[model samples]
Target: MDTPGPRRLAGRVWIVPGDPDPENIRGSVAVVADDSGSVVVDAGQSPAHAREIQSAIRAAGLPPARWLVYTHHHWDHVWGACAWPDVEIVGHVSGQEILRREAARPWSHRYLRDEVRANPRLGPSFRARALAMQGWDDFTILPPGRTFTDELTLPTGVRLRHVGGAHAPDSTVALVPDSKVALLGDCFYPPPAHLRAPDDGPDLAMVRDLLSDDYEWYVDSHGEPTTLEQARRLVST
Candidate 1:
């Protein structure tokens, strides 16, 4: 609800921040535009979120993104790809496998049932909303037609790199050469211990390797966007 857009990154680049409390919404979506067209890094969690992103896109005076780069295979970032069905999707091979197995599945309803079975206090509203947001009838999971092991030159004027981090398996980091902004999906920091133990699951060494002084800013799905200098310090800590 924090005025979704016109949040400039550098020049024609901007960020459409996700719902900070995206228990039911989507993740932060990054956008970069040029003469060729615009590109988005990660969609949100539901069709409603996607529609919001679309509004932001139009308000930005930008065309629909030519491509969608999933930061990882998590539902929060990739589920909303349905909103931009024409955009060419990009992600990792392992993540493709996940899409094949789980995308469009009744995974949301299944999870909800599990929760309600354990705790009746959850009530029906939560279940109803979850199902609706899951985009049941037209729900989909689009595997990146273009797969990469390490790096690739994306059509969207981004140097895409497969940055394996403490997050999910198919993490990608996009660096806008002209703007000097790095759009890194949720590949930093660990989830709270209450949600999941601090696995420190990402490859910090890989992260440090990816973190160079060239980028001016690093964008993630949540939290304050960090600068290259600041992110290096945070990584060390």
Candidate 2:
């Protein structure tokens, strides 16, 4: 619930959190800001949260969002994307398909029912959050304007390399090469394991190897910024 501190790296990249809670919402939205423009990595829980992200971008003297990159098709990650009107949205080709499927399914409703069944203690909070998320109809089916399997570069000189997936079927970790900072979505999070482990799509070993090669600082979608060494240690354990 606390606001995450903003961080800046070498390539004029900034990491801002859209949501910090891990129990209900498993991911934190991030913004990759540079001189040319800003690209929102993932939309947070609601339109208001997405608006807060937009406000943060404006406060930092950046232009309107030029692009949106969905790490995967998870509801929490893509729901608020409608807040950005007409911006080019980008993601993996598989992610595009997942988004279409999610649009047809009662994802939020199912999540609410599952939350109550799994943890009765937090059922009230879960219902409240789920209802808040459902009220946002902006999650229209918007396919990625640009899709890639391996990697893609934005006009602002940010390179989004799809190292491997960890959190979801179409999940990808975005790397800003120049900054040596990687936006490893829900692939990595702080310890004590609050959420269920994602099905093993991209082997953790592959992710570890990818991180070791070029990344120095890693900005996770859930927790605080971590170093490659720290990530390796976490994965090893």
Best candidate per TM-score, number? 1
Candidate 2 accuracy as TM-score = 0.77
Residue 81 of model 1, lDDT score: 81
Each model's lDDT comes to: 0.73, 0.67
Instruction: Write the residue-wise lDDT of candidate 1 on 188-231 in tens digits.
Output: 54542234464555455666877876778887777668888887
Best by lDDT: 1
Estimate candidate 1's RMSD in Å.
3.8
1-237: candidate 2 lDDT, tens digit per residue: 434544565465677654544446645666777655677788765665677777777777766678898876666677777777757888888888777776675546676688679877656556645754646444555557689988788887666666444456666777777778888776532221234344423356755666666778877676778888887887687
Model 1 has an lDDT value of 0.73
Q: How accurate is candidate 2 locally (lDDT)?
A: 0.67
At residue 149, give the lDDT of candidate 2: 87
